[model samples]
Target: MALCEAEKTFVLHGVEENFRIDGREREDYRPMELETDIVSHAFGSARLRLANTDVLVAVKIEVDTPFPERPFEGKLEFFVDCSANATPDFEGRGGEGVAIEISNTLSAAYSSPNVFDLKKLCILKGKKCWKVYVDILLLECGGNLFDAVSLAVKAALWNTQVPLVKQIDIDGNNVEIKVSEELYDCRKLDVEKAPILVTVCKIGEHCIVDPNVAEEQCSVGSVVVAVSEDKFSTILQTGTGSLHMSTLVDCLQLGIKVAQRLDAALWDTLTLECYTCSTTEDESDTTCLDNPSGVVGGVTDCDKKYCIIVRVDYKDPRGKLASILRSCVDKPTYTNDVIEDETHRVYYRSCRTAKCNGGSGRSDSTSDDNGSLGDKSTIYCPGIGDGAVAVTVSFSILLFAYAFVRYVR
Candidate 1:
């Protein structure tokens, strides 16, 4: 979608006033919805919806021979596919250029060992190692592709569960490595210091962090800065326009600050998503969602961070609420009730295994009001079950009395 001069000016004026079209500040980002394990076939997968932009990333691990030059390190490759559904421009081979650009940018950003350690994926020094393939699918493009893609990739990696190596046997020229067969018995990637790419666009004299479709058209040039920890991992100049040396420095500074904020926010969101959804093989089991460390009901009262409960209404007269809940959440959940009032309703509570602090670090054994995990009892609403049982018993007694009276007569 092309923005006219008048529309561009409106966006520029809003930036100047620190109020965007969506009523967000210059540094503020649009509301984001993130879900992990969306792709059952893939080892680790995540879907991130950033306003109008939607991105899905899946991580697949394969065992392959390590490079002769870098015998100790594993391999990380990125492949991007821009679906035609996102835009007509991406039809057929039309999106190949954009896809290549995105893939190359991600490859460069993650090339540094400090950003992602490849040594951890090694099985046998030079013979065998895990090759991590990160496949990204661009479902929707609403501008700010670089930022959204990076965030989704990081979240997918965090949600990924790499199998643990139990035993390795090497006989003669043949070498064998045994990985743990248990589903949950896996190792988690240390993505605490993962790099986050932030795109800073030069609009007039000021620079903006996240530019919308209209705002992007008004930019003179844009710089994508990949921030890792306190330093910059890679800086790439995008768009056709040029930036002065001073302007470039200013852009880097803005990019770093914005990336920090973005990284923190991303971790908070990922943790929340992980906490609410259990990574259990049997998602239908309500017992897995129970947290032994906290009070009843998904969210606790003492917890300061607010929990967002999403209510979905489906148009199924037969009421397939259990299947719907299973499709959305991997955690075990019981249907609390089917409201017989104004509407046919099913209520589900978010499950949490451990306490999440909306930050990078999560407690290993702490439980809060949100619920707990690991052999904990599931959240049970006694009133609904008891009432149903009472009604059934009363009906059975009445039927028995009528049958006896008829027989006697």
Candidate 2:
């Protein structure tokens, strides 16, 4: 579908005015829908819909030998499949090129040790480890596919529950291992440093994030940046046009800023509490979202403000002490009225639990109970980012965020 000269001019004018065709700002993303644990057979799974683009990711684990050179580390593999249902052009082997590109991008993003700690998956020092297979299915291609796929992968990894190994026995060259039979006794992957991909498209003179298919087609050039922590793990350029060094730098900075906000929003969605609402038959018959307390299905109030603060104290064996404190608050609030609802899960393990404050205004502090800290070790579980919760309203459904934590020496 090609845009006419008038349509392209209109889009350029819209960008110049800082308003997009969908009325979104330069950095704004389309309404998104995310759901986790959808695949029962897979170890972990999540499905995400960003407007017309749809993505599904599943995680599978297998026992295998570790790499000879890096025996202590496990393996992570990514596989992408572009379904023909999305478009006839993707039928048979037509989509293979796109699938390979997406998969390679994912592999590059997760290639760094700081991004994902593979050592945690090691079952034995040199003999055995867990192989993680992340399979992605692309049901639709609206645009900004890279960003949508990365988000889905992160959500699926967050939902993954790796079984705990109870013990290991060795007889001759044979190695025997025992895994916990209890379903609840499992550990979660530490994805705090997992990378998120952001695609920044350069329009006439402006760089925009989350470009729709039409916007993508009109762009001169684009860059896909993989962000983890406060740095870029991988940066790949797409499209044919080239950018000046200054323009490239600006795009990198913009990508970082956009990725930070996106990361925060994702964490907020994953940590939001279940919002309960009541509705009558009449209310259901009419528009439920219009009423303040009615229903909106997955749409939520992005205007609602919230804040969260977390403090963690770590004491090493040498008596060195370190404290990590983080906090974030919704300052002015977003102008968007409706957003997709997303559910998140958390697990906590600690000797002394800290009380949390709620709502728009909150002031809380961590307990100074160092009495139990002298003789025993303590593990404190922290939320993904600043731990802020998103405000939500939905129709006819109640959802709760679950947290599970395990203690180990």
Candidate 3:
């Protein structure tokens, strides 16, 4: 739908006020949530959500003959899929145009050898080399897809786990590669110098960062700037509007500054292995939402139930009451309950619930006075079998819930 004159005027006025419709300054960005190592089946994977925009990236490695001219280097290919989930207009081949545009831009950004050293991926000169395929799935489009996709792709590569090459045997015209049998004996991709793209949207001669859907619709033009360790790697103009040389240079400078900050923040989050979740660093699993089997505590378990709990320490009465209830049960199955008291207001829901009958007995409450449930928390199950399988299954659910509530918040 087209925006009315008054709405447009309001947006323009807001921009003049140095604040956009989303209550953010022109240079401010929407809240971004990132998770790496999400797709286990792939070599490396990451999921990035910037406000309403959701992007998933996976990297797959394959052996292939190197190009005759570039025999010493490997190859990197980008493929983007604009899923129907992003928008009904993207159903089937409808999103192909946008997908191609995004993929092409990514390819251009990574084409420079300095941005990504293809030589590091080569298994052998001229004959065989590792081909890295970066596949991006767009789940939702809230705007600023280019920036989000670029960040996801970089993060996925950072989390990529490459198998260790034990030996390479060449016989006649055939080449054979031996991979390490030990799972942990893998090589991690070097991504310390990965590039991050930032989109600068020009609205009424003013530039902005991380524009939302509404803002994108109003912007006349945009410039995508890719920066690696504060160096400008690539710059591409987008949209139909024309930009003067000086304005384009100004936008590029701003984009580089923003990208440097973004890259640092992303690296910090990626390296953070500790979380409030119940699972230890060694036990945590990573899973993506697009997979048929839901990712539970980062692990792919299609048949199991998973829940995410957010704790609010606010002094609102409603929040305090909900926290109290969550603390009482090992797993809070009552999602509809909204408790209000004099202290705080809270919103909590049951992500998943499974009914299992076990031994008939009431178990002691394992929660604390502060409404915190520990990792060893348990619930009474009636008619549950005494076998190890039953016990393991039951405990896994509790552990999943505990970890979900702890980390997802």
Candidate 4:
């Protein structure tokens, strides 16, 4: 929607005052909701809702011959489909332009080996490699599409589980490849150096990190910076507006700072998401929304950085609240953010990658108010049966019974 002269003035004044229509500061971003593993058929999948803009990402893997020149690296391709329901402009081919732009941007951002090590995907040099197809569906486009797309792509890749190649047999010019059939016996992509894209909008004498639809309409130009760790991987300028060299420098600085914080938060959320969900083959297990290191038989996405420990001292009378606890909750993850009790102590402890939920890292506190992964016996784990399946199913049920409950009244 085009902003009227008066509306543009209003938005301009807000930027000048450092307060946006949504009460956000210049560098502030809209609150975002991210969920992973939404696509079961795909190797990895994630759905992210940044305010009104919603994006769904799914990863599909296929075995194919590598490029002759770059035999050591596999392939990564991105496809974006902008749903017609997102906006009036997207009703037809109008959205294709936007889709292609985003697709190309992502392509460039991940083009470098230093940014994403595609070599890890190679199964056999010059013969076979895994091709990862990241399919993105844009359900809504509230604004700031580039930033939202980058985040969802990173998360989906993090959740992806690449099938392990067991062996290969070659006869003459024909090549035969064998892949591991066991589920979860797969290699996960290391996204520690994945690039994150941040869009900085230039308004009247000011720049903003996340520009809403109206704010975006009023902007003269925008610069998108893809930050990889502390380095700038790729930068693009959009819109007809031009930036002075000094202005461009400022934008890059802002993009890096925000991207760093964004990377941290993205890692935290990914770790937190994997922590709460379990991976047991049983489809009937109670879905754990937040347990980072799931108990036995549980499915866990072992993309670890910092593990979160939740200590719940059962203060209620024996079996009194079990029935009630099983009935009144709805949302992802059983977190203190949902249930607040003085006895609950939640601590984030740093841990190694791919370790299960029970592995303890360094302790954050020692007293009653603290907990660590090392004190497993001290932590909470409801026993099911001795078998891995039994243990996984039983633990999932007791762990997240509250997360599935909804207040009917």
Measured by TM-score, the strongest candidate is 4
Taken over the whole model, the C-alpha lDDT of each candidate is 0.66, 0.66, 0.66, 0.69
Residue 184 error, candidate 3, Å? 1.0
Task: Give one digit per residue, the lDDT tens place, for model 4 in 147-226.
Answer: 99999899899889888888889997778888899774677899878999999999999988879899999999899999
**Where is model 1 poorest over a 10-residue stretch in terms of lDDT?**
387-396
Stretches > 4 Å off in candidate 3: 273-409
On lDDT, the leading prediction is: 4
lDDT of 1 by residue, 155-233 (tens): 7888788899999899987889899987656777877677888889988778887788888889999999999877898
Give the local distance difference test score of model 4.
0.69
Candidate 3 global TM-score: 0.67
**After aligning candidate 3 to the native by TM-score, how far in Å is the CA of 82 from where it should be?**
0.5
lDDT of 2 by residue, 1-409 (tens): 6898888888877887889998877877787887776788888788888888899999999998999999999999999999998767799999998889889998999989999999999999888899999999999999888999998898788768899999999888889889999875777787767888999999998999899988887889999999997899899999889998888998999898777667656654543322222223233342221232233342332211222222122223322112111122222122112112222111111111111221111112322223331111111112223443333433222211111111220
Q: All candidates: CA RMSD in angstroms? A: 16.3, 16.6, 16.3, 14.2
Task: List TM-score per model, in order.
Answer: 0.69, 0.68, 0.67, 0.70
Q: What is the lDDT of residue 321 in candidate 2?
A: 18
Candidate 1 Cα RMSD (Å): 16.3
- Model 2, runs deviating above 4 Å: 272-409
TM-score of 4: 0.70
